[model samples]
Target chain A: MNVMIEATKLTKVYQMGDEQVHALRGVSFAVQKKDFIAIMGPSGSGKSTMLHIIGCLDRPTAGELFIEGLNVQEAGGNKLAEIRNQKIGFVFQNFNLMAKATAVENVELPLIYAGIRKRERRQRALAALERVGLSDRIKHRPPELSGGQRQRVAIARAMVTEPAFILADEPTGALDTTTSGQILDLFAELNDEGNTVILITHDPTVAQRTHRIIELLDGRITRDSSRNGVGA
Target chain B: MNILETMRSALWSLQSNKLRSFLSMLGIIIGVAAVVGIVSVGLGAQSSVLDMVSALGSNLIMISPASTVARGGSVSGDAVDLFTVDLANHMQETVHNMSLVVPQVQGSGLLIYEGANLRATLVGTTPSYPEVTNYHVQTGRFLHELDVENATPVVILGSRIAENLFGQANPIGRELTYVVGDRRHSLTIIGVMESKGQVLMGNYDSQVYVPISYAMERILRTQTVSTLMAQAISAEAASTAVGDAEFLLYSRLGTTDGFNVTSQDEMLETMGDVAFTLQLMLAAIGGISLVVGGIGVMNIMLVSVSERTREIGTRKALGAKRRDLLMQFIVESLALSTSGGAIGMILGVLIAKAVSDFGGWATSIEGPALAIAFTFSALVGLVAGVYPAMQAAKLDPVLALSHE
Candidate 1:
């Protein structure tokens, strides 16, 4: 019950011609409440695969994944959708905001799925964008804004739902150093507000900001350690 | 989600690709329009026919002896037995709402007057002929009851015939000799009838009229009338007159199955049925055009679905249900068709009116025809939209999301 994400012997396989490629080789892990964990690994190391499975966007080939004490492996698409709607917020590396929609509209995407009324969704989306300090740029479309601004809009979109877990797959991967620092400070502020944050990054500097880091090499965790005090 | 929200979203999405959406709707528009226009034209034709039939006098009925035309020869029934003086008298007395009855005999003859001669139809009829039919005297006067009783050597010339023979001179009180079969009879023209105009049959003012007794005794040489003409009290009494006349004639003749009794009402009803059939045929023709239009819509919508893969993915990710997406597309198609149908209906009515006004025909634009055409067009849209909407709604969200 204390574990937020409990993966037991989770494995994912792919068919490559006549051979089976193992993405996750019976990997198991856990994270407690308010834990800010970073997942780090080289390319094709199954870090992104693990994040996809944990985000309920894909199912593991074999094993059980429990989040908030509920089994997710057998849940149907609708149930997974509901879980994704209410419990998880994802930020992709490429900042996948709808091209036609403005910043606030993108942030209101999850609330729209939650069946919130238009006026209220707009208000909440605006508040979340203000928290990321993009309040004046609500009407800006993804193309109209800089790469960093688009990423902040995506972060606001993730945070607007006020979900239990924030899943950032390299939130600052496309941002400059200055914009990366701003986004990292926003994520730290959200973690300070007692929201569980899970960031996956290849940059060690990005991983250093989290309370704990889990480093994987070739689909196996080579290091799992806390830094300063807090899950540290 | 509420319908309004769904519609708003649909409208927004449609607004994003105005040209594509409009093109997709083009099919429905053309289809609905074709249906409305064609049916209106058909209904107008039907109305005109009915009006012409009504103007011919509602109490009138045409009866001809049933003849069998064979490859070798033709067989004619005994005309005397079918239309007799006794039968005419009985029809006048027994048929309720009966006004008058006139026995008629007809043959082709030559009328000679003032050294001018023309081939014309010779009609031997009672003085009541003018009353039973709608023809009236335009010159001197019609043959009176005295003329028929006395079997006077007198005649009534139709306006056209009188003009040809007399050349604007007073045809009444003039002498004309009619040659029929092998004999010629000198007759005085006592009256000239006004022209009633020709309809489907032919010109009315091209015939000459004389007493039935004179035609039978002097020319035909047989005690048999070729036809009988009966007048009803009013147009509304036509059906009653037909029923009563049929019953009276059947009882008098002691038979019913071998004869066909018809009134102007029956003729008009037959014409109405024909007009309705024509209207249906026209509607079907229009429907073919609509179906082609629907195919156009389907083709365009397929393109739209393909082009909007990312949009569909976005909507699916936004939690749009399959039914919602289906409804959006269907509604869009319907709006297009209905709008087009309305415009087509106006165009059809205008076209029908123009024809009616120009040709002086008794034409009409039927309301029910317009309604049916519009509804049918909408149905076309619904049918056309189904496949494309399904294709759009069934797109996998992951695949759509990954699409550019």
Candidate 2:
């Protein structure tokens, strides 16, 4: 099996004026190709900090993190940005779409940052939108779309660059139960199509649907469960 | 991201807030328009003044008695009476590069012909006055040397005076009464001068010309000449002619204290300096407005950056580097000011045209002024953008994303 993400003793400390706040303490995890994993934790459990570090949006105060065999800790600011552009895709709870950009334009964001040519970038963006079952909403802006449809557009944007894995931080947090089910079904279908996915959530029901679940408490992993007992 | 993509996104954001963008650009527009319009008007006035001077006469020099007070000397009647017809003739004969010399005596009087009466300036001069001063005879002939020798009581009516007194009838061979104080003399109008229009000195078409001999002996009863008009062989030789004439006058009068010699080119140069200074002052006033406009731009850009904090965070999360965000914001401000400059240039040209058309003022738009105005506006945009762009680029993505 190919390991897409490898972490060793990741620790994060933030300064609150003169005092220090520990967000993560010696958290260790590994995700393999095509694995659907959910990081479950209550509020203040440091799950958001872990998501930020894994998505390369930030660096841990002390840790070794590797994405697709490249050391994330050794990368400079611009280099980390490049790594994120090529290897990691992010889906935020708020959809995080440019309010003014249409669905197709929003999906084209990663490709633009990757310096892809315009014609090819557009073609790939259109294909990504179609893959998310949003072929008809290509010209609609985020404000004009429903909660489920906007989340679909954001998922399409994340997948447009063909990154190694999708890092979703509470992707269904803003949706109602029915819409959240539909989004989870889409994520399941994407994962089944051979894309590794990391989902962060606090709901036990949401964690149960994934192949593996890692629960954290007070910045430390309290449980790791795998149905097949592979890499557990 | 590429620069084109950055610029495209910048333009889209500006379009989303059209009213704010246009409001920010208004300052730059007014500043550039004022600069272009005022400088053009100043240049037009300068050229017109130079044209009027050329029309007065070219390759000409004027020598006159300086006021005793100007030289910080006590006034003396003998020194004031130093200019005479003989002295003019002697200087003309002795000075090199001089083509013609005419002595002049001037006085204002009322003329009466038939029942028409009008006030007019009377000039006493020689036959060479027309040639030296660029005035030509329309009909009949100018004063002859024989007239001066005989001190004949004859005069030439200017075109306006002729029309005023004779009412289209031939003024030549007619008689008009010249009255000064209590004395009145009957003079024959031998000729009428062509219209030379108004010049820097005064209206040439409102004066009457007579022989210098008659003007001194019969009219004002004075022996002194008021001015000496000397013409050089060519425009390039006027300076040499002025120097030689000044030296001759100094030697003859035994001092250079009483009289001053000046060339037309020197007068043009002085006028040019005054025009240049006026233009610089006007441009400085315009520049102040541009600085104020730049501050307005800075203020608006800061507001825009704060308003779009979430967008910046989204782009950063999407892998946009720090420089990318900086470039986008800077490009937005640059577009605003450059477009304003373009519009201002068009407005300025229209203003110049309107002034020339209805205000009776000459206005010329110069290319360099337009270029400088545009370049300065662009520079203003760049300077104004830096601080706001830095603020936007330095935002922490996590904090920005969480911001309301």
Candidate 3:
């Protein structure tokens, strides 16, 4: 399998007035294509920071990070944004669908950022929503959709760009257990269809649903292992 | 991103928040409207005043005895006769570019024509009076130098005088009898002057004009003419004509206090200066409102950026360039301001039209003024949108995403 992401000693430090807060400390990991993986951690474990770096939403303070063989650590904000548009899809915890935009419009966001033409963007967005089993909810706004359906639209949005990987940060954080199960099932289905998926969550149940789980603690990696015969 | 796509998205954003957009545009609307309306009104007033002053004649100038002071600066020059027929004749002969110089003597008389009696002004002027004042005879000949030389008892009746006395009958060759002082004099009517209703001086249409010789020698017997009407060759030559008249009058009278030479150009310039000042003051007032509107736009846009922090983060994570979010917010504000400006333009025009049609005020609405107002509001939008757009663009995506 082609390695989609490689991070060697990634570190993130933020200055909170007089003291520095180390969100990520010398974190290292690799994500292969079509990999169904979970980064499991508590609140201050820096999984979100690692996800941000992998998603190309931010650069590491001190480290070497590569996505699709390009050194993302050296990329500027605009370049990283372009890289993200071309390579990474992000699903947020809150569904993160623009409340005013229709489901199809929300799903079309990444493709829009990728500079796709209007007709093609719409067609692909429709197909992505269909793939997520949300074909009928395309016209519904976030407020009009159920929690599971809104997350489905967010997945469709993340899927529309055909990126190297889908990075979901606590994707089921706001949903109930049944909705969360449905969203995880959709993610598994997407992975089965040959899309790489990355999940950042603290829930052990969600972590066990993936093929591999990487646990982080105090901004450092604690464990990286694969479990056979899991739901991929 | 394509500009068209960005604009469409901006439009959608604004559409989703209708009330806030309109309330934000209110300041701009009122500002552009006030500016356009005031300028239209001022321009109309200026044009009307210019027209009224020009109706006398564009290159026309009037020479009158200046007001003089005695003791406490009270005007006491009513008894002074500062001008004579000779000075007028000299100016007419030697004045450069002077088309016509007509000396005039004013008097009041009672006319009796076939039992129709009316009290009217009697003007004694040279044959050149018609040329100087642009008063052309409608039906008959104007006063001639031969009639003046002969001191003939002939008169040119004003159109109103002819209309009142002869009804529809031709008054040329009709004998008109008039009482100048205590004696009744009969004169042959030669022509009727064209109707020039009421001018600044008085109603010329109700007067009668006779040769200077006949009016002065036979009627009022005045040798000193109080007023002189001079027509310059063109608007450009009026100053030269005035200079000539002033030089001659000053040389003869030996005192500048005796007479005043005033041109329509001078009156027009003075009135125009006053109008300009009024327009500038109005523009300042209008500009204040527009600035207030701009500030209002800035205030709302800043608030909008703050409220949409999460959305900005979403866009950023979705691979949107910082410029995308910046452009989105900026275009939204621009649309708000320009739309407000357009509506303000319409409102201003309506207000101006209402004032002119209903309030009986004059107002001129020019296309360029509307363009100016429209463009200015768009500029205000651009300037006002800058800070908010920068704030949005500068937002950290990680922090923004964390914003509830």
- lDDT per model vs. reference: 0.76, 0.89, 0.88
Point out where model 1 deviates above 4 Å: A1-4, A14-21, A31-38, A93-98, A101-104, A137-146, A168-222, A225-232, B71-100, B103-143, B146-227, B231-261, B318-371, B392-394
Tell me the tens digit of each residue's lDDT in model 1 across B1-404: 55676566556666666787666656655555666656656666776677677666657865534443334563344333667767788778876677877778887888887578899888888877776677788977777777767778898888888778787788778788888767999999888999876644556689888887777788677777777767778878877877786776667556564456677788889999988887777778777877887777677667777877876765555445566567777666666556656766676677667766886654556678778877877787778778988888777665675587
Clashing residue pairs in candidate 3 (N, C-alpha, C atoms within 3 angstroms): none
Weakest 10 consecutive residues of candidate 2 chain A by summed lDDT: A223-232
Query: What DockQ number belongs to candidate 1?
Result: 0.22
Q: Which is the winner by TM-score between candidate 1 and candidate 3?
A: 3
> TM-score for all predictions?
0.75, 0.92, 0.86
By TM-score: ranked, best first: 2, 3, 1
For all the predictions, what are the DockQ values?
0.22, 0.65, 0.73
Give a tens-digit lDDT track for model 3, residues B246-343.
88777866666668898888988988999999998997798889989999999999999999999999899888898888888889889999999999
| Better candidate by DockQ, 1 or 2 | 2
Of candidate 1 chain A, the 10-residue stretch with the lowest lDDT total is A223-232
lDDT of 2: 0.89
Itemize residue pairs with steric clashes in candidate 1: B31-B290
